[model samples]
Target: MTTISQTAGYTDLQTALKVRARNPALDRLRCFLTLVVLLHHSVIAYTYFGHTDPKSWIGFDAIILSTDSFFMATFFFLSGLFIWPSLAHKEPWIFLRDRLLRLGLPLAIAALTIIPIAYYAIALRRAPHISFADFWWTTVTVGPWPSGPVWFISVLLAFDLAASTLHRLSPKLVDPINRLSLRGYERPAVFFVFMLIVTAIVYIPARVYFGASRWFEFGPLSLQSSRVLLYPVYFFIGAGVGAANFDRGLLSADGRLAKSNWAWIIAAMIPYCLLWVLIYMKREILGNPVWLPDWYEIIYGLLFAAFSAAILFAILAYFLRFKRLGSSMLDPMQAAAYGMFLVHDPIVLWLQYWLFDVDMPAIAKALIVFVLTVLLSWGATAALLKIPGATRVL
Candidate 1:
C-alpha cells in the first residue's frame, strides 16, 4: 500500500522521508484551535480592560484562560512535530529560510498593518483626541506595543533561534534527544515524570522573577519572553516525539489506545475544572492575592499544562477515528486562519468601540463583538490573502 509520503504534493522530496499521514483530523484540530484563540482574544477586547464597563460581567473570562493556553500549547506542539522531519533532512539554511518566510513575513505584516489598525481603534475609544499621525508614530516607531496574538510568533521565533543555536554548538545533541524521546515513548510513566520535573524547574523561576511580562529588560539582550519556560519545553517535546515516531496514541482509533486516550482525558479534566474553580473562588472570596507563592504557581501551572495537553490530544484522537468526517467543505477560512490571527485584534478593538455606547448587558455586548470580529476578520483575511506575496506566509 502506498503511504502518505508517496502521495503527490504531500511530501517534500528534498527533505528526509518521514512518512506520516496528512491526518485531516489534525488540520481540523488546527482550525478549531485557531477559533478558540479568536474567541479568547475577542472576549479580552470586550472585557473591562479594553472597553467594557468595569462593573460588567462577561461570564467568559474563566473559560478564556483555559482555551488560550491550551490552544497555544497545541499550536506549538504541532509546530514542533512538523519541524523535526523537515530539519532532519533539509539543509540548515533551507530550513531557516522556510521558517523565515512562514513566521517572519507574517509578523512583519502584522506589525505594520494589523497592529497599527488595532492601536488606532484603541486610541479612538480611550483617547479620541489622538491624531492619526501620532497613533501611527507611537505604534510603529515607538516601543514594543502589544500586537495582540502576534506575540506568539515572536516567542516561537525566539525558541526556534535558540534551538538552532543549540544545533550549531552541539551537533550530536539532536541524536541523543531523539534516542531519549524514543526510550521515553516506550516508558510513558518516566516521560510524564520527566516532563513534570522539567516544567517545575524551568517555569518556577521564570514566572516568579519574570512576572509574565513578554518583554524583559535584561541589559543588552532585552529578552523577549512570554509563557516563561512553558512554550519551549512543549516545542522541544513535540520535536522529540516527531523524530522518534512517538504517537502517544493521539491519532490512533482502535482498541486499547483509543480507550486509554478517552480515560485519561476524563481523568485529566477533574483537576483542570477543580483548579479553575479554586482560582475563581480565590479571586472572589479571598480577593486577589498580592503575591502567589512560587510553589503554588508551579503546581497549578503544571497541572493546567498537563490537563490541557491531555484534553486536546484526546479530542484529536476521537475525531480521527471517524474517517468520513474529513469530507467537510474547505473554504478560504482555512487559509485565513493565520491572517485572522493577525487581523482579529484590530477588528475586535474596533467592534468594541462601536458597541461601547450601546445599552446592553455585558454578556450581550460581548456576544455582539464576538460575532462582528469573526466576520470582519474573515473578510479582512480573505482580502489580504489575495494580494501578491501576502498569501505565502498567511
Candidate 2:
C-alpha cells in the first residue's frame, strides 16, 4: 500500500540520517591534527638536539614533545569512529574493497613514491653526491626501507580487516563497549578512565621491555614496538562507541564532555607536565644515560599513557562543544586533509633541505618552512582532487 511519494519521502529520510551521522566536529578535529602532523615534521630539523641546520630552536623541542606524544594515538581514535557503522552498512567484500582502495592504495603508492622522495632529502644531507634514484633503489632493495607517516594507513588497513572479521564472527562482540558508551553520554569521565587504564596496561609493560625508541620493521611495514597493542585498544574503543547511537553515546556534543571541556584540559596538562618531569629526571638525575633502567621506562610509559588519554578526551570535548555552532574554518581543508597527510612529508623535507644553509634563526626557518609546506601541500591536494576520478581514492 506504499505510494511512490511515500517511498521517496522514506528514502529522503534515510539520506538525511546518513548526513546526520557524519560528525563535522570530528572532521575538523582530524583536519587540525593533520596540521599538527605537519608542524611535528616541519620543526624537527630545527630542534636543539637534532639541529641538522645551523640554527636550532628550544621552543620546537616543547612542540615536538607534545605532538609526538598524542597525535598518532588521536589519529587512530578518530579513524576508528564510524568503522562499525561502515561494517554494518556494507557487505564484507564491499567493506574490504573500499578499505583497500582508500587505505591500501594510498599506502602502497606512498611507500614506493612519497616516502622515498621525502627521505632522499635527508640522504642528500648525509651524502651530497648521492642521486635520488640511487638512494631510493638502495633503500628499497637493501635495508632501512621506511614507510614514514603512511605507516598509519597500513596499520589502519589491518585494523579494518580485523574489524570486518570480527563483525562476521559476531557483531555483538562489542556490545558491552556499546553499553559503556551509552553511560558515557552522561559521564564522559568514565570513558576517559576506561581509555587511560586500557592504554596504560597495554603500553607500560611493552614500553619497559622494548624502550620507547624501539621500532619493529620489516621492509616498509614498521611501527613502534611499544605501541602495537595501544593503538588497537583506542581503535576498538572508538568502534564500540560508534556501534550504536553515535550522537547519544560517548561523543555526544550536548553531553557532559562538551559541557566541561575545561576540566578535561586541566586533567591533560598534569600528566603532560609529569612527562617533562621524567625528561628532567632522565637528563639531570640520570646524566642522560645511554641506557635507561626499567623503572624509568615504566614511569615514563605511565605518564605517556595518561597524558595521551587525557589529551584525547580534551581535544574531543573541545570539538564537541563547538560542533553545532556554525561552519568550521576547517571545512575547506577537510577534504584535503588525507592528501595533505600523504604528501606533506616530501614537501617539508625538501623545503628544509633547501633552507639548510640559509642564514636565519631556527624559529624563522621553521616558520617559513611550515607555512610554505602547508600552502603547497594544500595546493597539491586541491590540484590532485581535480583530476578525473582522483577523489575516488586520494
| Model 1 regions lying over 4 Å from their true place | 1-21, 46-51, 165-194, 212-226, 244-257, 322-324, 329-332
Q: Please write out the lDDT profile of model 2 over residues 152-256, one tens digit for every residue.
A: 777778888898999889988788888898899898888888878889999999988887777878898887888889988887887788788888888888888
**Estimated TM-score per prediction?**
0.81, 0.94
- Strongest candidate by TM-score: 2
Per-residue CA lDDT of candidate 1, range 1-394, in tens? 0000000011111122446655555555555656676677666644432334432664565656556546666666666655556665667887688668766776777767777777687678678999877887775666445455666676667666676766667644555555655554334444555655665567656656654434553211233343556767777766665654445422334423334556657756876777777576557875867666666566566666566656655665565554446464433355666666667777777777777777777778777877887788789878877889876566
Query: How much lDDT does each candidate structure score?
Result: 0.59, 0.79
Best by lDDT: 2
Q: Which 10-residue window in model 2 sums to the lowest lDDT?
A: 1-10
User: lDDT at 259 for candidate 2?
Assistant: 81
